[model samples]
Target: MSLRSRTAGAVLALAVPFALAAVPADAAPVPEADPFVWTDLTPTYTATADYQYEPFAVTDGYRPIGRCAQGTGTGEGGAGYHYVNPAHVGSLDPAEPAGLLYETDSNGGRALVGVEWIVRADNAAGAPTLFGQSFQGPANLDGVGSVYTLHAWIWKDNPSGLFAPWNPTVTCP
Candidate 1:
């Protein structure tokens, strides 16, 4: 065979096995369902952050099922917090990055969507601590299995006061 053809054949031979090895047979990663895409979750409110009792409402001891990526544990509690929004939300402490929580409901009349966010801030004692709240709203899906936009009203609670942060809404394409 010619030199070019011989080199091409050798390259394919090496790549074929590696590509096949990447696909696991039994232990394949399971993709977590996207409530936004699945139409199973409500979609009326995009995402917002406010002190009111709307979506992002502040309540204690409530968590949702989420995933950072495949092959990772479920983010039901605070255990699987490694899953990040690639897009950094604000200039918060790296060690205590902000959290983005999600909840959804499918019923039409009852709006079932809530988002919880946690950031480093001062508690009532005036000490550096973590505070978070849930912004909830009605889930209005545009269409079944259709793409829609998600928005959140995010802010910073520091000594200066509450400030609207960057990239508050998360759009689902």
Candidate 2:
């Protein structure tokens, strides 16, 4: 081999390792645990008769907040109906989500799709994170007030991502 070619090959080998080391370790994609496997939420599935805010019933400490429709824009599918448990709002426990998300079918049936973890902005020391994902906002949520929220599309697959606030496949009546 020529001397020039040998030197070029040696340099390339040394550069490769340094280039790889520059990438952040956290940037690597990490596999996450399924967020939907909760046995403790059994009572929420059956408690649909009691009303806490009228029209919306309080089922196992959760009451229906509202349904959000798909927004106009590329990939801006809106979040579905939110059923919030007031008691769970401030806690960051992954097993105890602050709210449940449901998608309404044409037959007027609701299907469980995801879970939401919320912490009121005013009550938080900083942005709250769970499942390695940061909460989205301090935006004002009607009736619930300003809060930081994160959604995990557990039961349903989201095209956007697992932690995305909106799901394109979800629609409301």
Candidate 3:
């Protein structure tokens, strides 16, 4: 074979085993809902639309299904927070966070977990929608008043349901 063809064949030979072995019978990482720990929990929120979350979070307690209501986690609760704006209503920006999901550590540090999509409810309209699904809010929020939201356990699996308001599987770190 020619030099170009020979070089290509060698490259493919080295890649074949990796391609075939990359997927082991059971090599998937633990579910996001499972107890995964992250390191940094930075604060980042900026509103770019009319729809938005209340600047101040209202209350902290068990949520719709007893799962900690995100930022409302108790003294020893996990610390999940929102950091987005109404302009993000239908944003497709992968890095434009809808919200920051966190699990607080023993030292009181917050570990990043999943992300949430948040939007506001206009007096004249219904909830916002994205990713082929409607945003979750339109329900009354404690700090920012009433709004819509979506929980993408993209980083974790929620036993409470992938899109459930609160993740039943998330635990304090």
Candidate 4:
């Protein structure tokens, strides 16, 4: 081989390690803190905000659509629905749920079931993701329109799956 080629190859070999080392060791796509982690750290915060906010109220653009326990995907006694919040279109919190799946108590109080995400961005151009997961459009989940949505069992575990729309573990009151 020519000296020129050998020298070029030698330079690349020496720079490879330096380039690789420049990157952080924990550069993996894993999230630093997810719903479970945040809720564990601040259970009261999650509960308080969820119950007080009443994200699923009729005024919140989240209409009751189904029930999970009896064939629907909503909670046992409570129900879930298709939701959209134009006001919070691009909001996202790595340490908290962008939205909450709620279950009503016997006393008519709201309880936390899981977390939800909904975006009304055009083509989801500004949608957000958490825990290294991306926001999927209606094409992936059950929905229609340019909006995107996702559900995570960050507060409660879902035996069926973590990303399942409903959490079988969260029973209604």
- What is candidate 1's CA lDDT for residue 146? 16
Candidate 4 lDDT over 65-116, as tens digits, reads 3333322544422224333334444456533333456666567765555556
Candidate 3 on 93-137: residue-level lDDT in tens? Answer: 443544545555456654444566656566566765544456665
Question: Which candidate tops lDDT?
Answer: 2
Q: Order of all candidates by TM-score, from best down to worst?
A: 2, 3, 4, 1
Evaluated against the true structure, the overall lDDT of model 3 is 0.44
Clash count for each candidate, listed in order shown:
19, 0, 13, 5
Candidate 2 vs candidate 4: the TM-score winner is 2
Which candidate, 1 or 4, has the higher TM-score? 4
> What overall lDDT goes with each candidate model?
0.25, 0.64, 0.44, 0.46
* Model 2 C-alpha lDDT versus the unseen true structure: 0.64
Name the lDDT value of residue 137 in candidate 1. Answer: 22
Residue 117 Cα positional deviation in candidate 1, in Å, after optimal superposition: 4.7
In terms of TM-score, how similar is model 3 to the real structure? 0.47
Where does the lowest 10-residue lDDT sum fall in candidate 1? 154-163
Q: Which sequence of candidate numbers ranks them by lDDT, best first?
A: 2, 4, 3, 1
lDDT by residue for model 1 over 39-139, one digit each (tens)? 21112121221211223322321222244212122321211111123233222332222234332223422121222233222223221222221222222
Tell me the lDDT of candidate 4: 0.46
Ten contiguous residues with the weakest lDDT in model 3: 39-48
